[model samples]
Target: MALKQSFSQKMEQKLSPQQIQLMKLLQVPTMELDQRIKEELEVNPALEEGKEEEEDEFEQEEYEEEIGEDERDFDIDEYLTDDEPAYKTSVSNKSKDDEEKSMPLSSGKTFQELMLSQLNMQKLTEKEVLIATYLIGSLDDAGYLERDLESIVDDLAFSQNVMTTEDELEGVLHYVQELDPPGVGARDLQECLILQMERRQDGDITRYTALKILEDHFDEFVKKHYKKITAKMEISEEDLKDAVHEIIRLNPKPGGSLKSSSKSLQQVVPDFQIVDEDGKLVLSLNGRNAPELKVSQGYKKMLQNYSEGAKLQKKDKEALTFVKSKLDSAKWFIDAIQQRQNTLFSTMTAIMNYQKDYFLTGDDTELRPMILKDIAEIVDLDISTISRVANSKYVQTQYGTFSLKHFFSESLSTDSGEEVSTREVKQILLEAVEDEHKRKPLTDEKLASLLKEKGYNIARRTVAKYREQLNIPVARLRKEL
Candidate 1:
């Protein structure tokens, strides 16, 4: 046998250059297309924005040139030449790219930054400043520094190469709490409220009332145990009202300021809008972020010039091939954007039409049965594709802004053997909870029985599952002392 090797050769996994380009285009959303185009212009130097008059003239001339061509026998494959220039016309005036642009630099500093800026004004030792920095980092998304001193001490030691103890962190936490936005770094609600209260110069009964709520009657206060609260605090109705107001005024989540630290709030520019125009609903795609992209005009000119002037060298051929591949990719991306826009409209329009009654009245009860498959069949798209579009995408309807995925629900059988959406059952469950007496909130079994009485016929476990989805606590946890 011809030299047979004992060891098997390894196959290298590599993506084709065209495949890489497609992946890049797929990663960019419709909104970021302009930024992507501008970046390409800076790097390639061949692309240029056409003047309005020039674009108009080009369209007229191109139309005239095609007048004699057979209307019924059009061939896109033939027009795409090996050395031809690729051009893309703007389809709409509104580009999605505007939303991705940076906010104006003139915007004022946020509440959290104002607090940190105030920190610089205070006279403090280097160690105190270092500890303060460490403490600020631990605050959660809600702006509360919910973590304990030991965890913070460990973070400082690991991240800053500075040894710290619980005592050092505790002192820093106390000082930071005194900073502007009074309860900035408090470990809990009680501490957050107490810090804000201690700063008040009046020394009113409010502080004492807050102390009672935070220290002793926290359980009673949360459950809205007004009778028990007034009796235990030994206060009159008017005094109890004032104290309850003070407690309510305190920051429940201390670290709410931390949200400003990372970056400014994202302005949610919706990708689609469904609005009520007269009695009929109008659906529109926000193409403001989408840009008109084509092969760089310079790259196209270079390829044409080289191909016409001389026989291509190996290097020149390689470059031309690369440019052609990129041009193909650019065309595919433009097509995909057009396709994505079409699919979005087709899918959402079907949704809007299906739930027209709900949108018109702004009532959840009128929401007709819908699922991914129902939309998929209507739009002629795969269920998974529909799901992907719906998952993160939001639509601004007359009723409100909602995720497209919110409309999808699994089927449930009714008494007459008709399959109803599980969403209808959830709505009924919510109504039951909302109408129930808070003191003796309906238990899972009672909720299940009520759902059955309403002809839902759902199991107790299913009722419990739906209850958890609504974020309502269990009967015991929901109970007041």
Candidate 2:
């Protein structure tokens, strides 16, 4: 009998704690970085926003030399002695500037709050109120109660502890639908439109005709089969157009209007600003992107007191260890922030310079083909790192604010063998479609031909794909009477 032993060798890569922390910090956009910093400041007493004097102190060589010496040969075991009692350190008061941005209290009621208030106005039994409240909660952002009656019946019994039937829920839903938005609790698009139409004047001919079209010919109406609708209904062309227009004017998304009125609109915050100065593209990181940070001076003084002592007391030794640990964490965070700033600037600068012509002229056709790999190689970083920066960050130029990822597109070869950005192809395709005759809209085949004639060697299917990406409908749907 014989036994065998073997050995193998391989290389592996690992990330240190500081490296992992930096990678995570790099992915957060400028808008969220402030909140992330606030969180860190709350948890780490040794980390705080730097004052002007603290910034000046860090710049001095002597302070750095002293800090480096203290950190070089630190020993933790020297502090943990069996004879010594643990020392209690007082928690630092949070700086007022470290407090989170407080959102002002909204005076107006939210959509759901408004619905509940209206429900209160109805003199219903307690059970009816419970069922009605549950129904309102089931509605989606578009104000449609998409849940089936049976599911809602089961939900009421199980979740709300209220025994109810489908008929009772359906009866209560009608009252909820009578809310101010006119179509608040409809189950579908057709039902929503019907509810809104029922709110019009009783004898209005346009409303009557619109209701008839929607009630009986909804499928035909959606497909834009105006010819069939006119012939089937025996209506005049002008009258039919007016009826369809009336239906079009009704809100399909009633809940969306409620949401808009309830919430304030958010403004886009760009992470970088680019300017053209005498034919030179100047890049500046957003002021918020580079926040001032420093390790706590109080913590440093505690360490210095211990270091200067002739005989270290147990309390002093324990305090030194705690302060040193916090100081290390604070130092790591500050360095990571600086690295994040450097990486963001380097990546953005390379992108701006790479797409120089597009930035200079504000012409989308001038954009060159680029990918994460291209910029990753240029900046000497990983593809994932570049992707993180590109996906979450935005830049504002004289043209407009755009996501950093918008500039990176796959390469497409033209008939002349020139490599161009797919973005360029999409822009040209968009222009052709926009200029198309709606009565006889251009099909994907024609669109592809038009692009080829203009030097893009795109196929019909590819044209269809790009069209879909641009959210343009098929030629049949694009057709108008």
Candidate 3:
């Protein structure tokens, strides 16, 4: 078949750079917005901190008009040469293997560093130290060393120029596991718990029994088959309960304890604050969300000087173009930030009004059925835009700080055929689970039946889903001696 010549025209809707910037800014929470602004100020010389000047608009228009009159060839896109493809210049020249990719490690003492510090404190030979270092570095964020001893042996030989056997590695690993946080060098969940219990045994029968249970019948313990464990271990119900208690007290994620020390404390700054001003709700965007940013007046003066010249030199045109680009960028960024604040406030205000009763009463049952589209329609924006506002952003209320996402829930019909928020149902489910007898915890079916008794008409699967979402385990797992 021969191809036919084709001449067709089509239009595509695309996000402009400014729009893209606004969308991204909309997702930035209050705490990080300051850092993001500082980064922008560093890159764009035309942007400056402090309140935007009142005369900035008039001066900017003057400079822009001057540039329009002269320097017709002064275009920012001119920097992109026709000889180089735009995408190619923006992309990496190195192959995937050649690229140096670094993991984003936490600040302060890392998990590896903590182990190494402990290693230094202990008396170990040079070879042992290197092997232990490798092992510590191999531990994942969860604190478990998931690699096999054989593979680690091979790795030490090939990468670290160290020779070792599985037996020697095990010896070093035993010492490593003895370090802080208790379970830093275990290979799996069972080993992690056993390592922790080993430190806490203290010759107590409960701890001893717990260690034995973990060492032998870990599967049975996990499955809640207490009868089988009591039969095999030949322990009484009270002894088994004490053993289980000891096991439960142990940290499942030993590395997680290290993470707090290795990372700085994160403070959540609400992006919006809603106040109950006598029966009326008043919404205000966080002051940080609306920073005073303006294009540098110095850059504007330079452009004005260039534009005033009678004749244009190539260098002059280039300098003018550069200043214009910076000024334009700074202006765009400032506008994008303002739009972000407006978008956030409007979206959150709509949500506050939509769930007015909930915000007023601090009761989950008062929240109305709402989704992204409901607020999107109210704000005359896209669902995705509303989602972005709801993503990392939080709002401060009379009750407490909550994510914007907390206010939005899918609707669930009640026995009265009235639509209610799934959040309300989850609240009821949570109360039921919390109040249920631990000796015989409520099942998903039982929970659903209870919700129906309270007028929430949801299915068993949904109840199970909600239970899991609440981080509640099954009834069997919830059972105790």
Candidate 4:
């Protein structure tokens, strides 16, 4: 085959660097946006913090004429002018004290570190310590030993060249399980519960009864077959209730109890705030989302001085190019931030307006059916842009702070040919479950029938799907004696 040249022309859509920056800025929350601005300010010396100065229109126009319009997309003088919108506001996502002061970093030991500290205190040999350390590393965030002992044995022999057997590892694990925060190092849920119960096995009848229930009838207990358990254990319902009360109080996620296991506890900084003033809803963007920024005045003066030089030199031209690049970058960043504020405010405004009834009443049933497309249409932006505005962004209302993604849900039809948000149906299902009689919880089919009586055209399978989405378990597990 031989290479050949052909002429083909096709129109394409590509985002400019400024557009890409705006898109990225839209996705960052208020807390991150502040850090991002600091990074940009550090890297670009031409950008600075603080209020912009009021410049004379004649001077600004002259500066614009000096920096030719054909060389760049935006005028630097426009970004430096004081007439720009006041982006900074008083409200913050945190409390007034939080805004004044920041929380100190945590200096706490991780789960593995705590486990190793306990292991070191135990009477174990050097090689056993390494194996126990490896075992500590294998536990998940929930504190369960996810890997099997046989695989760990093979891994130790193959990777570390430390010959070990299943029985040996099991013996070491017994000591690990005895560490603080009970139920950690267990293989599965059953084992985790059993480990916790074994630690609490005192001479008391209630404690022994709970241990026996866990040790023998764990499967029956897990399935919530209360009658079968009562019959098998030869215990009354009151006695079984007391025993289960003990088991229920045990921590299932012992590893999660570690302060360090929560990777990073991010303080939620909402991007927007909504207030109801005499039944009218008002929305405002967070102060950090639209930080105060301006091009460095010193850099601007440097450009003016270089341009006003009597005679131009090669070095002067290079300096002018360098300063111009920094100014351009600063201008682009300021413009992107402004556009992000507009896009964010517009998208959220549409969402708030659409769900006005819900926000006003603080009722989940009042929420209207909404999606990214709906907000995109109202804001006249792309669906993905609306999605970015919704992602990882929260809004504070009188009721509580909620993620923007929480407002958008799929639509379902009613018997009266009306469209309702699935959120409304889920709210009803949640209320039904909450008010249910524990002696005989309603099944999915019964839930569907009840919804049908309420004029919500839902099917039995659809009820089951909605129930699962709400994290409501089956009727069998829901039943209580």
Instruction: Identify the leading candidate in terms of TM-score.
Output: 4
lDDT of each: 0.66, 0.81, 0.80, 0.83
Model 1 poorest ten-residue lDDT run: 55-64
For residues 1-481, could you state the per-residue lDDT of candidate 4 as single tens digits?
9999999999999999999999999999887888898899999998888777765654432432243457445444543445345433223343544444234355467778887788867898887888888888989988889999999999999888899889999998988888878898999888898899888877989989999999899999999988999999999999999999999998888888793543556678778889999999988777743457877878877766654455545676567778888988987888888788878888899999999999899999899999889989998999999988898999999899999989999998899989999999999899999999998999999898889999998989999999998899999999887
Q: Per-residue lDDT tens digits of candidate 1, residues 125-216?
A: 89888888766656666657877777777778888888978887777777787776777777676677777766763767766776767678
Q: Which candidate should be chosen as best, given lDDT against the real structure?
A: 4
Residue range 97-148, candidate 2, lDDT tens digits: 4344433334387788888889877878899999888888888888999889
TM-score for all predictions? 0.72, 0.85, 0.84, 0.88
Q: Which of candidates 1 and 4 is the stronger one according to TM-score?
A: 4
Those runs of model 4 whose alpha carbons end farther than 4 Å from true positions after fitting are 1-9, 55-105, 158-161, 259-262
Number of colliding residue pairs in each model: 13, 0, 0, 0
Model 2's TM-score against the true structure: 0.85
RMSD of 2: 7.3
User: Which scores greater on lDDT, model 3 or model 4?
Assistant: 4
lDDT tens digits by residue: candidate 3, 192-293: 999999988787889999999999999999989999999999989999999999999988899987766788667676777789989999887666334567
